[model samples]
Target: MSCSECGSPTIDFSLPERYRASLSTDAAVANCCTRCLTVEPVTDADTDASTPEFGRISDAVPTDQEQAIPLLLALELADSLATNRDAIESLLRDVERAGADPLLAIDRLARDPDLEPRVDLERRSHQIEQLLYYSNN
Candidate 1:
């Protein structure tokens, strides 16, 4: 990865073992862009036992909350960084699949420093419920 500030290559960080265990599937990984210092998410399908893992990267970016912001931001980042439409769309679905509660989405949209959108929080919440129902199929 490249730095957002100077266009230099960026570094990556990983989630710790304990935190990874807290996640549902441990199928996504976090990366801090070197250029922008932004936290980026990548699906864990690309990962293997050879990949490095760690605890949370920083307190400035904690993973304890059921906040939709992380999932939303990760989706957007995935779209922007992805190579093709198919890949981007896949990431979008993942975002919708993994995001937090509608209330959390609303709260983040209302207060996030990045001004991310959460307008459809109620509808999306309902969508998630329905999706979950169908997923049981």
Candidate 2:
């Protein structure tokens, strides 16, 4: 089955009951992909949940700063990862040294079409945010 978010073909059989309860009868067994669900996680609302949606800062119409939200999230994820730890950490220090706000930096990128993270990175960051939402709930 295809993931509701990324449209990947991977499947996740071990969806928690809360997640499963959120699905409709038509797609109880095959809904979102593993990478976009269990591995990366995704919004239940994106998969057709009747529950009220909440906590999506980017849900409002995309703005200059809103668009950069993904890159900021990706950088945060990179900061947490072992491989990109040093580079992203150094970059974070540079951001601090320059007296730059990361959100402002992202907003600048969003305003500049040519300077943004590639589409793939943006999508991954959004997906990660979705996963984070599920975890928080």
Candidates' RMSD to native:
9.9, 16.3
68-132 per-residue lDDT for model 2 (tens digits): 22223334344244454433444434444545444444343334443322233443443433333
The alpha-carbon lDDT assigned to residue 101 of candidate 1 equals: 42
- Model 2 is weakest, by summed lDDT over 10 consecutive residues, at 52-61
CA lDDT, every prediction? 0.37, 0.35
Error of 1 at 133 (Å): 18
Clashing pairs in 2: none
**Candidate topping TM-score:** 1
Global local distance difference test of model 1: 0.37
Candidate 2 regions with alpha-carbon error over 4 angstroms: 1-82, 114-116, 119-137
Model 2 local distance difference test score: 0.35
Model 1 per-residue lDDT at 126: 42
